[model samples]
Each structure stands twice: as structure tokens, then as C-alpha cells.
Target: MTPHDYLNIGAAVWLFVCWVGYARFARKRARTDHCLASVLHVYRKTWMIEMLSRQNRIADTALIASLERNVSFLASTSILIIAGFVTIMASIDKVYITITALPFANESMSPRQLQLKIVLLLMIYVYAFFTLTWAMRQYGFCSILLGAAPAHDADIGEAERRRYAISTAKIIDQAGHSYNYGLRAYYFSLAILPWFFNTWFFIVAVGVVVGVLYRREFHSTTLRALVRDLTATEAMKKSPNG
Candidate 1:
């Protein structure tokens, strides 16, 4: 293999490592840290438990439907993107010429190499489509779980009610996680766009993507506000007479 081929392999490896590594780090850190996922997980549990107190659950079901719609939209978009990639794969020569024509014209890689990059992007979107669809299905399951919950006035024990609510929330949490993975696919796919230019550009773009994801997930303004609100609510719940 040429040096450029080796660089391509190394860059691809770096992309996956950064992507997967950040996922693992976030998963572990979320157990103790205040990130979007953790904060949202807490809200999910609270929402599920609170839902048991309402005689009518129209609002709860509507909320689940909203989540399902969002996932469905992304899944549909992923299909369109995957189809675009497939079309591009069959016409790499034109793409190759277009890339090389640019002034900064990239690594002199052949059309075969460009096709490989496109295939990688296709695989990413395909994974995104599957994850998004799975998230939509999970949301559907959550709706059913809500429907099957014990009625508000049912004589269930407090412990049993809590147990059921927590378990149901776990389903929603899994759905949210699947949806997050789908989004991560979209983020990393942008990293591949720079690959058509050169491996160095590709590597740097991957880092940029990872950095952007890390900031939004852990340090964004929204996360701060959520954590603050949740903290205040928890404090209120523990106060005397609360």
C-alpha cells in the first residue's frame, strides 16, 4: 500500500477511536457527572414516577409521541443521506476530478480510495438509520408501558409503584441513548467529509467533531441550566413539609 493508503487507514482508525472512546468516557462519567444524558435520565425517571399520580395521562402519551416523531424524522433523513451516498459511490470519478480541481487539491489519492471513503460515510448513515429506528420503536414501547401502568387510584403499595415507574423510565432512557448514538453518527460523518481532501484534514476534522460533541454534551449552557433547576427541585423535595 502507498503511504497515502497507510495515512488513510490511520486516520480512519483515529476517527473510530475518538468517536468510540468519547462514548465510553461519557457513559462512565455520566454515572457521577452532570452531563445532558445524566440530567435527562433523572428527569425521565421523575417524569415517569410523576405520571402515576395523574388520573388522566393524555399529556404523558403526547410527550412520548413527540419523542417518537423526532426520532422518526431523523430516521427518514438518514435514509435520504444513505441513498445520496450510494449514488455518489457509483460516480466517484467525477467527485475525484472535482476534489483535485480545487486549489488546495488534496492528496493525490485515486478514485478507488475516494470510493472507500464514501462507503465509510454510507456505513455511518446506515448505522444512524438503524439506531434512530430502534429509538422510535423504543418510544412506542414506552407509550405502551405508560398505558399499562397502574391507575392513579389503584391500591398499589408505594414501593411497587416506584419500582414500576423506575423500570418504565429505564426503557425511555434506552430510547434516548439510541437516539443519541444516531446523532453521534451524524456528527462523525462530517469528519469524513474532510477525508476527500487529505488524511491530515480528516484527522483534524475528527478532533473538531469530538471537541464539539464534548462541549455540548458536558459544558453547554443548557446543561448548566438543567443541572441548576434539577438541583433546586431536589432540594425542595427534601425540604421540611415537602
Candidate 2:
């Protein structure tokens, strides 16, 4: 093993740390703050509240079905991607030749290095597959909850209705969180591609990926809009006629 080899391992470890650390940190913050996830959580709660007020739930059912379909599609695509990675691993000789021929690729990569890169990609996709499948299952659970939800004219008390809505919203929020995790895995997998070129490039690519994710999650215009909307909604609730 050389310096580059050690750096490659370090880069991979750092990438994994960022993924897990950010997820845990964001989950904790989302419980009380106004990050994108928290804003979405508010929206989910509002949705369930409105859903319980509606006379007909066809629209609500349609919305949940649409969400499930999206997760199912991504989960299926991840399986295909994992299969592609496995195929690439079986034909490593051709892949190595092609990669080495790239203009800026490091030509000194051993067979082991190439295999490691492919394995990293495979593992990323595998993680994505699991996340997405779990998201799909969670969505299914949400659908079941929706089906069992108290109707607009049910005899349930206001407190019970509120509790049911919050519980259902939390389940949907968890599904959304799982889907986001799967998407994050896909985003980070882009960093793995540069590993086939050089360890330094791989590290730089991981930094770029992390920066992009941070910006979108914490500083994007969308987050600002959601926060603004939430503030307005709260203000309206505090008004005398509200």
C-alpha cells in the first residue's frame, strides 16, 4: 500500500462519517428547529389535519399512493444499478482498461484498487436500495393508517383526532426521511466515481458532494420559502379572527 492507497481509505471513511453524522444531526434538529425536514414535518401535520376535516378522502388516498409509487420506482432503479455494478465487477479487465485510458485517470491503479472502487459503488447502491425499500414499506404503513383514520364525522373527540393526525404525520415524515437518505446515498455515490481516477480527486469530489448537500439542506432558497410560509401560517393563527 502507498500514500494514495491510505488516502483512498481515509476518503471513504470520511464520506461514510459525513453521511451518518449529518443524518443523525439533522434528525435531532428537525425535531425542534426549522430546517427543511422540520418544515416538511409541519406540512405533513397540516396535511393530516386537513385530511381529517375533509368529507371525502379520495384526494388523500391518491396523494399517499403517488408518494408510494415514487419510492417504489427509486427502489427498483437502485436494484438495477446494483446489478450493473455487479456486472462491472465481473468484467473488471475491460473496465480497468477503459478507466486507465481516460485522460486524467491515474494509470497506476492496481486490480485491488479498482475492485475497491467498484465495491464502494456497489455498497452505496445497496444502502440506497435498503433505504428506498424501507421507505416504500413505511409509505404502505401510512396508507394503512390513512385507511383507518377517523372520518370527518366520526364520533372521536377533538383530542383523539389530533393525536391520530400527529401519529399518522410522524409515520409519513419517517417515510420521507428514509427516501431522503436513499437520495443522499445516490448523491454521494457520484464521489465514488472519481476514486477510479485518483485518491486526491476522490477526496475533492467527496467535499464537493458534501458542500452541495449542505447548501441544499440548510441554506437553499427552498428552505427560506418554507420557513417564510410557516411563519405566515403561525402569524395567521395568532390573529384575532384566525
**Highest TM-score among the candidates is held by which one?**
1
TM-score of each: 0.96, 0.95
Residue pairs in clash, model 1: none
Q: Worst lDDT window (10 residues) for model 1?
A: 102-111
Model 2 over residues 79-119: C-alpha lDDT tens digits?
99999989989999998888899898887788778998889
User: What are the C-alpha RMSDs, in order, of all predicted structures?
Assistant: 1.2, 1.3
Per-residue lDDT of 1-242 in model 1, one digit per residue for the tens?
Answer: 88778888999899999999999999998888899999998999999899999899999999999999999999999999989988887888888888888877675878888888888999999999999999999999999999899999999999999999999999999999999999999999988877776689889999999999999999999999999999999999999978
Tell me the deviation in Å of residue 110 in model 2: 1.1
Full-model lDDT, candidate 1: 0.92
